[model samples]
Target chain A: DAGITQSPRHKVTETGTPVTLRCHQTENHRYMYWYRQDPGHGLRLIHYSYGVKDTDKGEVSDGYSVSRSKTEDFLLTLESATSSQTSVYFCAISSSGGTDTQYFGPGTRLTVL
Target chain B: AQSVTQPDIHITVSEGASLELRCNYSYGATPYLFWYVQSPGQGLQLLLKYFSGDTLVQGIKGFEAEFKRSQSSFNLRKPSVHWSDAAEYFCAVGTTTGNQFYFGTGTSLTVIP
Candidate 1:
């Protein structure tokens, strides 16, 4: 499990509501990432952080934001959740920068009605 | 932009049969390649990765992948398939510029008895 854990393993929310997912890791990895998995989209990067307070948008970062206040925790927020945001969310950590191996967390399944 | 293509959306094979999943990437430079397997409703597990040196990379669970620069491909192969191997497989390409990764849609494997 790579010492990674995601909160709210499964949740159902109403459309237009706010939702936040938490990813916590004990590995002290320098890099952390948020990804979404869908039926035809496979896995798409949502946001990533290289260090505390250092974050960047990914391929599908629109309508979503992230924060990394500490080295062990990265948070993903959907200010206004939409049905399109209903997907499996995964958190990953890497010891180094990109091109390094990433270990993934169990994942959180979110469904927006 | 960078993209990963998994030609086969799904594949079926009998138990104990050889299995191969294709992964092709379009990149200007040599990027790190990886193969991951995800069981139903679970997080992805790293199967193998190719960074440098030998083209053939061995990973956990009796899985291996061949990085063919000539073909711009890194294919995952297993000599014998197990029923437990029936899951979704994803291929990812990582670049050095940023903490970015492009993943293929996925290849759903069905191991029949």
Candidate 2:
């Protein structure tokens, strides 16, 4: 639970539509990350932010954008959703940097048709 | 390139049986290794981690992982399996100075009665 929450626990969207998922954390962790989970893929990093307004692309960041305007909130936006982007999204936070343990929030299941 | 290999995609063990999940990673320098477990419809939870310390690391839920630098492996083991331990286990590797993590495909554990 880690005091993390993801909005839109489940959603079904049409292809080519825009979608945004929100992650809010009460813990003031310095690092936040977005990951997508899929069958056979396990979990892959999509994007991550180390501080407000400082974000970096992950292994699968194409077609996705992220914003971290504040310490407690990180946003993931898909400009135009595709079926391939349909998967479970998870938000994670760590007190320190990458080497530290990460606590994950309940995931958001997105479906694109 | 960094990669994590989890040979077993699924494992079945009876209750009270011993369990071991294999994880191997490819990284140049000293790597940060971690094990995480996920239940149905739940977020990933940290089982244990190995940064630098004793080769054996203890984790939550009576789980332990042995880090073998020689073999580039960090294998998770539990002496007794519980029915509640049926879940998906993932192994991840992170760099000491980076914020990205590479995760394994994950192994699903089934605890049979």
Candidate 3:
């Protein structure tokens, strides 16, 4: 198993509140990704960082933001929580882009009331 | 745009029964495909991936997948399954040059003894 961990495994926040989820990896992988898992929608990419301070938006980037200031840490923030943002978020790491296998962290379950 | 479709939302099978999950993808070029398993409250674990070379790719946990170009399908199969294999399965397609991965809605597997 890859050395990856997500903080705040479970969280509940009221609407219009700010929340931040953290993903930490010991593998020093170059690529890190944030995704949200929802029923009937699978896992949708939120954001990804190729290297320190390099990030890009994914298919479902709205209402979410990410930042990676260091290789080992990637953070996903919900500027203002919404009921629609409630989902299980997963963080993954890969040594290479595209077809390379990605290892995932334990995941964070966030609830917006 | 690249997309993945997993038609079966849920499936139930006997413990010793052979298992197959269907996955079809849409992409302009040869696509990179992958299958991942997710247990309750856990993260996504890579089961198999198809990049190039042999059409049949073997992966962890006694699983295999075949990539068919003509059908635009990459189906997952296992000769025999264990109760531990009961979980949600997702099929994904990777972009040509980015870390982005597009996933299917997912299929929930129920193994009965």
Candidate 4:
């Protein structure tokens, strides 16, 4: 098991509200990623951070934003929640980029009404 | 562009029966492949991964996968099925440079005793 944890394990909120999910890793991994899991679509990458203040968009980066101010914490924020944004979000950490095995966090299930 | 495909949307097998899940990938170069299992309401756990070297890769929980370049496939197999193994499985393809991973739609496994 990796030293990764996600806060607000479960939440439900109305649409058009602001929501932020937090991923914290004690392993001090250099790479952190945010992904959304939906049925029949698998898991889609939302965003990723390689270092502090360095981030990149993923295949499904729309309606979501991420920030990495410290090595241990990466935050994903939905500026305005939408029904389509309801999904289980996962955070993963890797010591090296690509080819290296990534350990995942427990996950956060968010629901937008 | 790199992409992963899981042929079977859902499969059911007897407890003692052998199980195999098909995965095919599309990539220009030698792609990094991985298989992950996710229980209901849980995070994705890495079952195994193939980077290079060995064609057959072994993973945790008595799972193994063979990376066949000729077929562009990385199929997961187990000699005996377990009820606990009933979950969704995802196949992913990644590149050596980009910190990106493309996942398949996922296959749901149902093990019946």
Best by DockQ: 1
Query: RMSD in angstroms, all models?
Result: 0.9, 0.8, 1.1, 0.9
Model 4: pairs clashing at backbone N, Cα or C within 3 Å: none
List, residue by residue over B1-113, the lDDT tens digit for candidate 2: 89999999999999999999999999998899999999999999999999997999999999999999999999999999999999999999987656778899999999999
Off by over 4 Å in 4: none
lDDT of 2: 0.95
Question: Each model's TM-score, in the order given?
Answer: 0.98, 0.98, 0.96, 0.98
Model 2, runs deviating above 4 Å: none
RMSD over all Cα atoms, model 4:
0.9
Residues B37-94, model 4: lDDT tens digits: 9998888899999999999999999999999999999999999999999999999887
State in Å the error of residue B18, model 4.
0.4
- Among these predicted structures, which one has the highest lDDT? 2
TM-score of chain B of each: 0.98, 0.98, 0.97, 0.97
What TM-score does candidate 2 reach?
Answer: 0.98
B1-113 per-residue lDDT for model 3 (tens digits): 88899999999999989999999999887788999999987888889899999999999999999999999999999999999999999999887667678899999999999
TM-scores, chain A, per candidate? 0.97, 0.98, 0.98, 0.99
The alpha-carbon deviation from the true structure for residue A33 of candidate 3, after best TM-score superposition, in angstroms, is: 0.7
Better by DockQ, candidate 3 or 2: 2
lDDT (C-alpha) at residue A102 in model 2: 92
| Runs in model 1 lying further than 4 Å from the true structure | none
What lDDT does candidate 1 reach at residue B3? 93
